[model samples]
Target: MSRVAVLMGGRSLERQVSLKSGARAEDALERLGHEVLPIDAGPDLVERLSTLAPDVAFIALHGRDGEDGTVQELLDVLGIPYTGSRVSACISCADKVLAKHVLRDRGIPTPDWHAFSETAFRELGAAQALPAIEERLAFPLVVKPAGQGSALGIKFARTAADVPMALVSAFSYDRKVLLERYVPGRDLAVSVLEDADGEPRALPIVEAVPNEEDFYDFEARYEIGRTRFVCPAELDDELTGRASELAVAAYRALGCEGFARIDLMLHADGGELDVLEANVVPGLTETSLLPQAAEAAGISFDALIARVLELALNRA
Candidate 1:
């Protein structure tokens, strides 16, 4: 067994979730008979990694610096192998604006959206373009931070009047904000994992049904029992195939490797599915969609962790 450093609990808003994921991963690593070193990633990350010098880094960190290529670059400099996407892939997955552009450019179906940086709105009078944007995308827009995951800085704007406060909520989490057309329907997620032959395969689809809220926000995601999850998503043969295909396409288009979870929305009216965002380091908590999908696909939690670590080691 090799020495593994599980990085988690950064200063992001998703810190708690990352900690949970790290803890679970640690348990699995221990059970697999590997030495596990849990690191609460902070300013002393370099110092700690240098002193410890683990064989591999199993990143359980989420949001901001964790998923935005900051730590990946550091790992590269330290000559350490890390799990998940590379620097460019992390950059693409961490920013919602970039992810959507990549999906659209690859001929993948994503929701119609617009991106605005703080400079554009605060300095260049981008607010003047709001009316035109609303006219194009229509009402009930999904305003979200361009760089946040786990639905942290997402808000709904039912009308033109709601856009400002929604923008405020989104900009608070990130400098850039993504304004997307809301598809009022079922919540779906598909996790992609690499096969033994190094092929990316989409796991069974998982559907999240929020018990109380109209949207699956932060609380609905981590606070268990707030939502009900259905593995295989009850989709028909054709729908399942399409969802899986889109997921694999998104994964490859974003240059993701090892593993990733693709979140999507299935529209009720048109029955169309649109890509929301890709999570590079998905949560491993009890309620996280990836673990649930893995279980449905007959891969146990410990086995999943082992597979992820194996992929990283093999790549190195």
Candidate 2:
């Protein structure tokens, strides 16, 4: 058994969620016979890690400093092995605009998007740009911070009047904002784990259907019953396989390692499946997609944690 540090709760909007993830991961690791240390990553994370050195860091962080490669870089500098994507991949995947550019270049199907700053939108307003944007991407585009997760500062603009407010709100979370064609479809997510053999294994696909809301928002995602998840989602076998393949492809294309979750939009019209985003550090809570998928794959929570640690240790 290795000495593992479960790191979580950074100075990010997802701090509370991260703490929960860390707690779950910590418990799972302990049950698996690993000597584990749980640490709340705050502003002085570097100082804290310097003192409590561990063989590997099981990063349970989400958003901002935790998910954006900052913590990964710190671990790299400390010569400590951590699970998930490398520093560069973390930055590329965390930034939606950058990830889309890479995906588009690779001929991956994704919604057409445009990135703009708040000042540009404020000065130009909607009449000049909105008309053309509406024509190209159309109305009902998605507005979201270029680098964020858990649906923070995300808006669906269905009308011209909503564009300005959406831009303002999205920019508040991140200076760069993404405006993309909103694909009307069933929301689905797939988690992929890279085993010790360096092979990527896609887990069962999960279909997320928000009950009241049109899309999964912060409240809908965390609040029980707000969204219904169908694991091994009821899909045609071919569709399910395709989604799983696309998920693994996306994970590799973004340079993610160990494990990652890819979010997708399967259009209702069956036109095409669009990739939304990839989460290198997916939630580890009992109800999170990654854990649920693992459970479906015959891996218990403790076994999953042990596998992740084994992968991290090998990297060390």
Which candidate number maximizes TM-score?
1
Q: Per-residue CA lDDT of candidate 1, range 195-228, in tens?
A: 8766999999999877777463544554667778
Full-model lDDT for every candidate: 0.91, 0.86
Please provide, for model 2 over 1-316, each residue's C-alpha lDDT reduced to its tens digit, 9 standing for 90 to 100.
Answer: 8888889998889998899999999988888888898888876777878888888899999998778999999999999899888898899899999999988888888899888876776776633776788778987788899996798888888787888888888888998898899888888999999876768899999988777864624445547888888898989988988999889888888888889999999989954798999998999987889999988889888877877777877777
Global lDDT for candidate 2? 0.86
Q: Following a full C-alpha superposition, what root-mean-square deviation does model 1 have from the true structure? A: 1.5
- Model 1, runs deviating above 4 Å: 213-223
What TM-score goes with each of the models? 0.96, 0.95
Clashing residue pairs in candidate 2 (N, C-alpha, C atoms within 3 angstroms): none
The TM-score measured for candidate 2 stands at 0.95
